[model samples]
Target: MLSAILLFGWDFAMRTYFPEDETPANMASREDAPSARADGAIDVGNGSAGIDAPQVVDVDTALASADRIIIDAPEILGSINPVGGRVDDIDLKTHRQTVEEDSGPIRLMSPAGTPGQHFAQFGWVGEGVALPGADTPWQVIAGDQLAQETPVTLGWDNGQGLSFALRFAIDEHYMLTVSQAVRNTGTGSVALRPYAFINRTSANASKSTWNVHSGPIAASGEGVNFDWDYDEVLEEGPVELGNGTDWVGFTDIYWLSALITQEGQGASGAFRSTGGETYRADLIYDPINVGAGQTVTRTTRLFAGAKESAVLSEYANQGVENFNLAIDWGWFRLIAWPMWQVLIFLFGLLGNFGLAIIGLTLIIRLLLFPIAQKQFHSMAQMRAVQPKMKALQERYKEDKPQLQQEMAKLYKEEKVNPLAGCLPIFIQIPIFFALYKVLLLAIEMRHEPFFGWLRDLSAPDPATILNLFGLLPFDPPGFLAIGVLAVLLGFTMWLQFKLNPAAMDPMQQQIFMIMPWVLMFVMAPFAAGLLLYWISNNVLTLAQQKYLYMRNPQLRMQMEKDREEKLRAAEREKADKAQE
Candidate 1:
């Protein structure tokens, strides 16, 4: 009952807050989709909102002054409106160096009913879809058409003389390509440092209120580690944004991310998106160094993909390393993962889960048959001696020690072992645990239904509904499935107890009566697939036990005869030895 309440509460909470998948027509119905400012930032909760300004760097001055650009925003887009300028102190040898983009923060304004927004920046992982700019500013002069305004010489030091050509180009995919051409300009060898930087505007108060979600990935090799983090964000607050560490998580949602860095490698960095109306960013960097007079170059890609799994998969294939599974609990994945592959292989040939479970159970029973047979025979021997044992106990009533000794002697004489009958249960426990694990985690069963009312193999059977006074939330289905199986279990226990008649132990009787209900309650939350398997096993066990009992009714007699033959052999051997 408590479990049912918890499940219901969880469902209620999800529906009340999070936006479900919506279509464009219904989007207007949802009054909750917040708007973004000319500057990137979301206004949430309050009517009025504001954020910090972008750090303006004069790229021409930066090149002339040998200064670096601090990439502050989590995401940025090339200015749709370009600015024209020239590099200071450097003559334009029919050349130019400018920082420009078609847009800055890649804003996603979808037509879907569930309004959504994202910014393009560096993904948590450094290798996938990435943002332009590192920590250093580039020489700039924005124009309608792509052109180089200045050429700067790059080297390890001022005089060492290994130089590279730095060129920028705007490509078809909203891409800004930065290329470097290496040249050995001096007698001495030199290596150059390559880096980039980015900055973004903060989100408005309403936008800040949007929730934030991220996915993480980590890789460790050769004592070096890298952590890739990516997720969705929606919240209500002053959004502090940057491509840096030390950011608080978005609220009201579950998150899964990976963090990778080499063990013992001290690397510290942060990606901050301080504030943006619809902030999203993906960053990629290949921190490769140019060898002495030997130039090596690298490139990165950026993407603006939807949060859907299939869309994410496409971007991921395009080098977005932090690909996350969109559906937290996928409809079919859980049932398909782990053992589902194996199950499918077998089911293809055998064609039934029921048959598979039975076959598996039969194999287990056969494996335990030796121990089980011994136990059953022992119980049978004990049952056969019950009459004599009862008589001895009554006759020796007041002589407790004698009664016990005689009972032990009688058990030995009859070759009975009390614990033998418990072997089946002992064997069944491990099989139960193993089968339960397989069913619980196997994704293949998620929506795979058994016939009638058991539509989802991975979920609890939902066909049962009790509307009267809210008694049981779900009524169990099919007498043969639940009721009949339970009855068979009870009958089997009763028969076993009858065959091994105990001496009126009140505690034992009470335990026997209470156990079945306890087991039923324990199994209530499990998937119907698992429950059905257990029920079938119980039914089969009952049938097998009945068959064994009827076919070998004098099992105890045979055991006693074997014991007598051994005793007679020992006596004859003793007499022969004496005569000799």
Candidate 2:
């Protein structure tokens, strides 16, 4: 019955309270029918071609082969490939590849032709106007290097009447503002549409988990966000978002790459998984008509790098519609956002994330103190009536319905709820999932350290009892990676169970005894921060139970009676052995 209650409560919280957002109406309507060209090719609207088959090359060769313009900023370091005029080679200076301080910076984008080639490409595509393709070699017109203070401009001119120029400006952080302009230096008026696309040769290394979104996500200003898996994008062909303030990009566990546009701009966006391990998130603005001797320019923003909540929120606050939605806060944003804020506050107060988690658990316990007190008082009443309940059970052994009616009547008279014990677990279910989402999606928690042997709180505990906590030379299997924290979690759970009122049925008693150890094994693979939270929660609960039990005379009396009965049984067994 307890297991059923727990499972049902968890399911209810996940399905009802934290439901996945339905695919945006625009996306849903276009899912079955995508636009196609007259030639029977999948028209990825905006003049974007089908996903190109990637040519694999070594990273060193790809970097060395490209004639590049360097990009140097405080937060980002990369270069632009002139061959395609793609901002492709980027490394996030603020983030490392691993937890070690000496670890290399995280490589965010690699140039094309590499094994893990990924890049952002911006260009003009139009009919009868010979625009630059992937093979066009752009000439650096203005700045030699791209920086926060200095913007770089790359220009290319077709033998026809049109000349295109791209001016790139980057902030200190991750956002890049690219402005595309065209000059009709010929006799005839020319029409061209500006388009920006992020292309990747392979999916991210981090596997998409149920809790964290790690693939294509789009948000139309209609207050709805569409999240899709890479496989879904591949199987469903292409996802198109019609005119609105929308952003389309790929989100990994910690990093994000998105194309941003202005509000009410009639731009079209599409996400397509090209064959041979390639995926593209492309956006194209409406065509601009430039008369002879006239110039037209359009601007858009590109966001690439770590998905810092504050940075995303700042962008959202600065008129980027729903930019904060980039961080997958899930459906329970109301609860999860405040919870995350409090956690961040606690982390600021306390330097260590482990301590912050413990602080958060204490705050939750204090907040729910009144409800827990009532629950414990009702439990005490139930414990006091256990003897009467057993007598009633014996009296109505054959009449199950009558026994249930009598028990209900007894509970009413005693002012006790039989299911009141489930209140805490029910209250905790949402919090548990919220914290899980925060730990899984928050970049601040990535590679954040706790005390000894706990290097990365967001990652599973590395030390294992089976390997003597790394003292042994050989490595232990994943299931056997039970660390000290996991053991403490089980111990605290067991302690809380011991403090609770004894179950009436032997089977329930047995289950209660084994449930903690079972959960410890089950949670062995979870993040260390999550295990720390659970352990702290269990300990606090055990403490609360002990304090409540000590203050309640009825509970104290029941515990004393059970203790005396156990002692008497032990004495009787010894006496019987002596007589034998």
Candidate 3:
């Protein structure tokens, strides 16, 4: 057990310190890509990153130029590539590339020849069967537009009596249900394995930090495996984990493109490199034998869009196991999930994500209010017994354990819970961290407008003071990018610290005086919504402190007494220095 723990710790530390760089520093040449399959389809190993494909136009130009079927869903907008029936071109209609009015919709998946090459492909591989290849331009037989209300079907037929059709259906959100049906009209039994995979260029992926997983991610019956990132594929070539693969795909920080396997179907998934910084997440099922005139249909769900917490959770609730974890809520998800629900509810009520965050803070404060009361009461009791505690400490100065024991005895006798004052802070730490993770990971917080000059709460504050609130053209670096929210945060934190009694230790007092400003500088680069949350929390803390002080007169008196002593001690030290 000890060795396991130590091994895990060492692995974690290595990953944390030396996170794999998503950049293709050791990328193989495009010419070295795996050969095309016997069926003329891009080898499943060299999936759809299109390493050998020629360069094409820009994203918009590429989509406009392609002979494609339109995808006009509520939140997703793209085209289905008729060639190979690849769902290659996608843009999030609800999300934008930037906050600018003309920034345009976020380009989620672009054509293979384009820079943002990301897409999902579904087909079959079989022995003694003629399968549809990449060059096969599937004919649109049913629907004109692939919309939520209108489902589209693309079909192709091999000369050898094998008929293949891909029926595509979409919901109001990002889930695309792909039904791949193969009808064996021949005389003999046809054996083929149905498979789907998402392929993308690692160059376009969001940076995969050790904490927030990007690159290849998948979920099985056990749980989601966040271990294999693009770096592993870029370095190690092909990698496969334990089987029972439920879903497999590539995930960015805000976006994801996963192929969820059919329920109860035994499937194997793996990540592989197709050379030139391209990676693929393959979901392959066991081969099934279809006798003459038998049609085999496989349904694969493609999730390609923003990783909104609520949407992911909804999918998870509907039986997509661990789908909610796509957002990487981390260890604090117990608090984060409920907090996210409350935040969503508040947003619906308040009509602003930023306001909803403030509302959530208020709710957290309310939930911790009882603890706050107990904390103040404990502090008051401790204050009333301070002199007695000091006398006991002096008497047992040389006996450390005895001093702690006596202190516990004194607390019991005085009906004081000495540790109670710390309980609130301990509780708040996880809550605060949970909120931080929410702000960082939730796509719902992306591009949300807060108030004046505060657009895109997920981004750092734009009205940076160093640039004179965007009045001046001067752009400062990250260290100097103090914004209005950061200023308020520092000021509010200082006020909160000042509300407490002054520390007796000079160094500790100095640290308290400097800590707020230091934290302000450190936190300036965080999301504006997070800064807003901390500022709101600090303001509430000040109010709570005032009310608690009023409720505990003895505590207030103790605070005053401590302040006076600190002042007198400073003056006496100054006099001694002057005499010297």
Measured against the true structure, the TM-scores of the candidates, in listed sequence, are: 0.43, 0.89, 0.88
lDDT of 3 by residue, 102-218 (tens): 899998887666667777888887655568755678999999889999999999999798999999999999999999999988898887888887778877678877668888898
lDDT: the better of candidates 2 and 3? 3
Q: Model 3 — which ten-residue stretch has the worst lDDT?
A: 24-33
lDDT of each residue in 1-580, candidate 1, tens digit only = 4544554565566777874533321111111212233473322111111111222233233233323221111121222110111111112111111212322332321211112211221111112212122111223332233422322222221233543334444322222344444445455443232322122222211121112213221211221112223222223322233323211112111211112121222222223333322222222232343445565553322222122334334544753343433222223345323233455556566776645665666666667767766776776777678679879989999999999999888878887776777877876765566566556544334445567655555555554333222255655432212332334344545554444334336689766665554455445456667777766666556666666766667863554565676689899999999999
Best-performing candidate as measured by lDDT: 3
Winning model by TM-score: 2
lDDT of each: 0.39, 0.79, 0.83
Clashes of 1: 126
Q: In what order do the candidates fall by lDDT, top score first? A: 3, 2, 1
In what order do the candidates fall by TM-score, top score first? 2, 3, 1
Tens-place lDDT per residue, model 2, 322-361, is: 8888887887777788888888999999998889999999
* Stretches > 4 Å off in candidate 3: 1-45, 48-57, 64-66, 392-409, 576-580
Per candidate, the number of residue pairs that clash is 126, 0, 0
lDDT score of residue 265 within candidate 1: 23
CA deviation > 4 Å runs, candidate 1: 1-342, 387-414, 465-504, 555-580
